[model samples]
Target: MSQPPKTQHASIPEPLAHPETRGIELIQATQRHGRARDLFPVWAAPNVSVLNFTVGASLILLGLELWQAFVVIIIGSLPWILTGIVATSGPAAGTSGSVITRAIYGIRGNRVVVAFFGWFISAVFLALNWLASSFMGAELLGQFGFTDPVLAPVLVTIVVAAVTVLVAVFGHGLILRSYPAVASVLLAIFLLVTAFVLPHAQWGYVAPEPLEGAPLWSAMTIGFAILASTPLSYTNSPDLARYLPESTKPSRIIAATALGGALPCIFFTAAGALMATGIDAVAMDLGIESALLALLPAWLGPIFVVGVIINTIALNGMTTYTASMAFQSIGVPIRRIPSAVVVGAIGTALTIYLVMSTSLLDAVNLMLQLLVLISGPTMAVFATDVILRRNRYSGAELFDEDPGSPFWYNGGWHVPGLLAVVLGAASASLFLTNPAWTGPIAAAMGLVDLSVPVSLLVTAGIYIALTRLAAKRRPGVLPAVENAAA
Candidate 1:
């Protein structure tokens, strides 16, 4: 691997001490600080949400037995490992994942994916999380006898959006410093929730009329896809890891990122599954809040609401922070703070519409199921690029935009990389099964959704083969152009 260029340490403000004013710029070696372990809370605090509980419960509703649901949760959570591997690029490249894509898809070509996958998808997630938080916030208010339905939702939306956007606008420093405490508080509340909910679980619960053969397999695949979508959607892991020093070991980064996220995700999701066994599947169909609140004592209700809202802010804070970088990466001539405010404004609007016009439970299920088709291929291409270059990148060269720049191949587009993504997403669509639409192949195959694996394999295979062939024609292309900084 090529070494990052040596430069005198820049006198940047300590990220933990002040607002991170930087955008997508390269971080000098001296500017880099923080250990790999610090990333644990950064990733963990965000996953401690009721969304995981809903996903876990959906497995039982889909006809899986309790043991089967546990197996699915473990398998589905494996995508965090892929997410961790992608994070190694941040320290190696000394820049956010949004900028690193210039190396894979070229400057202009990258804008398309970055805009769609990075900005648009992230904005949608911001709205979804904000909506979740607003629901919980309103429920908390209702307990206080503030039950004016119209007035309650509006008030909750404002409070949730304000807290989330402010943290994001403050940027990286505050996030890192605050997440450990956030994670601890959320974890404690969830453990208390677990204590009250688990005893009511039917440990050996089975579906009243168990699905058989192809139907069973199809249900399992869909369930796995739903559970995996949360981790797979996070192609921005590198955004958080970008400030870590280059000397940070790859194994440490990968372990901390993967374990931190996967452990809580599995635990809470399984807790949801356990909770599902005790409730009427019909009652859960209403929403996680009603189902869960019915089981908890009145005193724990307010505490549970607090945990949900805190987790939402943590989740949306990370999304908005990364989405701002993505907006800049799209060639927008905007700074970080303004971009975050714009994202927040848009998310708040969407949250209000979702609250008034649609069922939150239905929207969540459909969005997650469809998201995997695009997110799986996008993440696969990024992980494949990181491996091909041996995690070597030039933070400065990635910023280069001239025609002579190494990344400006074939008129600012890496044809092979772009082709791989297009083909991979198209192929995955043929096997996708969701409420919006079922893919032809999936319909033919008794509704089995194989979109996740199909997308990853197809995207990775094409990129590797094409990248190697291109390297044969151009000697210095394979190992990342020797990192001009080196």
Candidate 2:
């Protein structure tokens, strides 16, 4: 990455003055003062929104009974346990997740991964949140007797996008400061939703009625696939954790993140499953906002709708911030603020297209399922790289654009890392199952999907074997940097 010409900003606040725009630069020690505990709110607040409810309802629609759905919801949440583990890499690397990829894949090679998987993942998430937020805000305004079918939704979409962009423009300090408040409010609103919906639930009304032929095996696979895709959904955790003190224990970070992400999702998804039973219509047909309105008491319904709007703000803000970082990693000349605006505009456009298109939900499901194909292999490659190197990386050299730097392998291509991603993604593609698309392997295996586990193992195993072989072929080909004992 080429260093930008430094420009001074005297008026900005200390915390928000994160003036360093270089994608690979280390976050200085002064900025590394956030606590490990803050990440709980950062992650938990977004899941506390209607997204979990929708996911819960989706599980039921996919053929799981209420009790079976609840069990799978809890089990599906297990993947989030890795959130804190991945967050720890931030402080150690002092860079955004995409920049850290240069350590695994060479700098140039990392761009292809970033463009198709990393940045595309962020944009897709932004679009999803943008649409949900806008939908909620439009509904809430309609409740206030401001219902205008054409103008209202458009206005709400604009407002939500504006708020997201402004928050993201300010960057790190605002994100850290806002999380606690967002989490508390969302938690309270969702609890009220649970209380009102549970008493109305028809516990024994397991649909003897036929909706679709989603088998038990297919339901479980889709459920697991949903959770597997979540890590990529909110890739900002590490970006936030990059500001945390290096001394924070990995265990504490992991615990806080796991609990914070898991509890709300489990609770709300269970509630949503119950809500699905009480309502006669399919959950998707009602949509989350309409379902909440139909199920919750009149007084709490508006409050829950408002909560969705707020939740989307928090989610999109972090998404924009993280995505801007990913964009810069693509060798863009833009700085943080400009990059944020550009990404926000793109997300907003996609959000509009999603709402206009009849295939929005199907497209979203397909993308989420495809996430396993992207993130699964990427995660495996990253884990293997860090473990083999024993966390030894020259942070400064990683930013160097010159030829001799360790990260600039074979004209900015790490052959083994590239090969690992290809092999892993190929295996993952073989197991994908979504409404829009199903993999050959998934079809052959009686519609069972095993993409996530299959991709991770293949990616890591191939990368390791290739690296070992390469090392033997040409002694001392890979550069060794002095390891940091920390």
TM for every model, in the order presented, reads 0.95, 0.89
Candidate 2 least-lDDT 10 residues: 2-11
* Tens-digit lDDT track of model 1 for 238-353: 99998888878889999999998999999999999999999986787677778888889999988998898899999999998988888788789999988888989988888888
lDDT tens digits, residue span 59-86, model 2: 7767678877877777777767556666
Give candidate 2 misplaced runs (Cα > 4 Å).
1-24, 144-150, 209-214, 282-284, 359-364, 474-486
| Global lDDT of model 2 | 0.73
Q: Which lDDT values do the candidates have, in the order given? A: 0.85, 0.73
Best by lDDT: 1
Candidate that would win on TM-score? 1
Model 2 residue 469 CA deviation (Å) reads: 2.8
Which regions of candidate 1 fall more than 4 Å away from where they truly are? 1-3, 6-18, 479-486
